[model samples]
Target: MNLEEYIKENTATFDAFLQDFLSINLTNHSAKLLEAMNYSLLNGGKRIRPLLVMAFAQNLDIKKEYYMNVALAVEFVHTYSLIHDDIMDDDDFRRGQLATHKKFDIPTAMLAGNSLLTWAFQILSDESTHPNTEVRNYLTGFLSSSSGHTGLAYGQSLDLEYQFGNKNADYKKILKMHDLKTARLFKFCTRAPFVLCNPKILLNNKKTEHLDIFGTNFGLIFQATDDLLDYRDLDKSVDLGNIMSYKNNDEVVNYCKKLAKEALASLKNLEIDSQVLTELIQFIIIRKS
Candidate 1:
């Protein structure tokens, strides 16, 4: 199957998994909270993060069922970040729907986000994710580090500081913020599949490091693509003027293409077939939303 078809198929499967996994056992007091969590979690998006997990799993010839929980955990973490992000950004809309904080109350939205974040670790720690205690421990640690203060949280703080506090933020600072806030999760998505593979493969530091490089470049491309789209959509709040002044849209597009190529190149030395990954990189650059 082609990349679009592959993504569509996997996205549907992941959506089904999320629906079943997120099914709320309602209590009278918590029904609204559950609704708020489900409202944002079930909301539509590209599902790129989970797709990356699945795609890399496929690259390693791992069974889809084996990685479903892993993929779900990634999605939950992503969703939780979005929930909190909306509140911090005070964005009224998410995926063209009311932001969780707006749809519910701020307290409810915060709780929902907190629940999702905590549940992501729960999923990762469960035997369903991986029977190996070592693997589970590693996954838990990796997710925590990537999503915690050193990773996404740090990046978000930098983003806020850059936008609101530092009028003189340079391209390097912005790129570093994007790396932490966005790329770290993408790094996890790409690298986690290797961790889920056989223990022998997991021990191969060189191979894992190669995958990390691939993920890092891919994450950069994803963010740059977003910046390009925001510019196209005339979202002036992004404060890309300094960056854009140095590099126009065409230049940014070329940079993303370069990063995509480098990402694919990182996989070339490995034995795995990376055609799907190549297509995914292309799709990231070309996708409109």
Candidate 2:
């Protein structure tokens, strides 16, 4: 299948959805900060986290609108993290645009980052965002915990330590840092819809645990692919972890693609609409960035 075609199609639709959602012009104190927050959030990326949310929700039989708020909110959290990350790492570019801190200022970026963080939860908690309280509650809690200290924040700590630590760090330890810093939220993005839509299906409902396993495995594979992408840049600027001395990104990416295939293999037995998601897994594995 043409995985690039699949992702390009879906991302077009998803980007439009994000624009429409942002049209709401929702606000809180610190209007300028909120504007900066919107600037970064709307600034482009692969939109992988949000896409995973939508893709998995579709598998669960939920449509685009049903998951739009959750997906958009997920993107918000992601953009906020990237903003502060660029500031902390002192990197100057993101997705080929000026890093948030540089585009604005350090303090402004910090407030803007905080602005997006709160807004993400606001979208989840907004009564109008979801049709049912149960779904809303599950999403709110899941996203919160994942982006909180237990996941993204702690991961950031690990990443900072590694930047100053060693380029040739143990592979296993590097994996841990990537997981907390990069994978945890990815884990959240892929699993949230399934869990929110049907916790029982995952936890105790014997009806379909395979999908849960599929999502978890899929998450791991996606995380690895992301790490591989960062390492692809020989300069290692986009990459947080110190990688092998340059020139082996091809081997690394191929290995990651293999892992992705294994993850998709786990879904072969699940009963769900996986047409796009199946393609998505492969697309992520092979994507350039």
Candidate 3:
């Protein structure tokens, strides 16, 4: 199948799975909170993280039941981050509609995000996620490190600091922020399959090291393209760790190209069919949204 066809089919399948898994029939005092959670969780997204999970696991002998929960778990944390991020950034819109905080109240949105965040761990801990307790525990710990203070959280703290404070961050610091904020989760997405399928490949194994490099570069490319797309609306006077702040559109595109090359290079020696992932890197560079 072609790239577009692959994306469409996989996205639809994953959406269905997510809908089935999160089916809610509540009418209590917390109904609104659940409503808000569903609103943002089911909100239209590219499902790129989930796609990464499936893509990496494709052609492998592992069952969907083994790795599918990893896909859902990533979206849970990702959606939670978006809801909270919209609040922190004070943005009024997400995916061309009212952000959660705007549709509901800040408290409701905050609670919804928290609920999703915890739900990710809860679902991953279930026996259905993985029969082996060790794999389930590994997935949980990995996600925590990816989304917690030393990763995305610390990156957001730096974002707020640089956006509002007097300190000036150089390009290196900005890149580090990108690694922590964006690349860490991408790393988790790409690495989860190996953890689920082959328990012997530890985090420091060569296979995982290459996967980490690919994920980190792919994430940097993804962020650069996002910055390129959103550069128009940003205040030119402020530097928000966006590569666009330091480079023009053409330059940012070139940077994405460079990162894409590194990402592809990281996959060259891996003994798996990375064709879809290779195409995905190109797709990310050119995507308008």
Q: Candidate 2 on 181-274: residue-level lDDT in tens?
A: 6666766776667655665555554434454445555555666666566665546544355434332567666656676665676567555557
Extract clashing residue pairs from model 2. none
Instruction: Order the numbered candidates by TM-score, best leading.
Output: 3, 1, 2
* lDDT of predicted model 3: 0.85
Q: Give the TM-score of candidate 3.
A: 0.94
Residue 235 accuracy (lDDT) in model 3: 72
Using TM-score as the yardstick, the better of models 1 and 3 is 3
Q: Give the alpha carbon lDDT tens digit for every residue of 87-133 in model 1.
A: 99899999899999999999999999999899889888888888898
Which regions in candidate 2 have their CA more than 4 angstroms from the true location?
27-30, 166-169, 205-223, 235-240, 243-251
Q: What would you estimate as the lDDT of candidate 1? A: 0.82
TM-score of each: 0.93, 0.84, 0.94
Q: Please report the candidate that would top TM-score against the real structure.
A: 3
lDDT of each: 0.82, 0.71, 0.85
Q: After superposition, how far is residue 247 of candidate 3 from its true place, in Å?
A: 1.6
RMSD of each: 2.1, 3.4, 1.9
What would the TM-score be for candidate 2 when compared with the true structure?
0.84
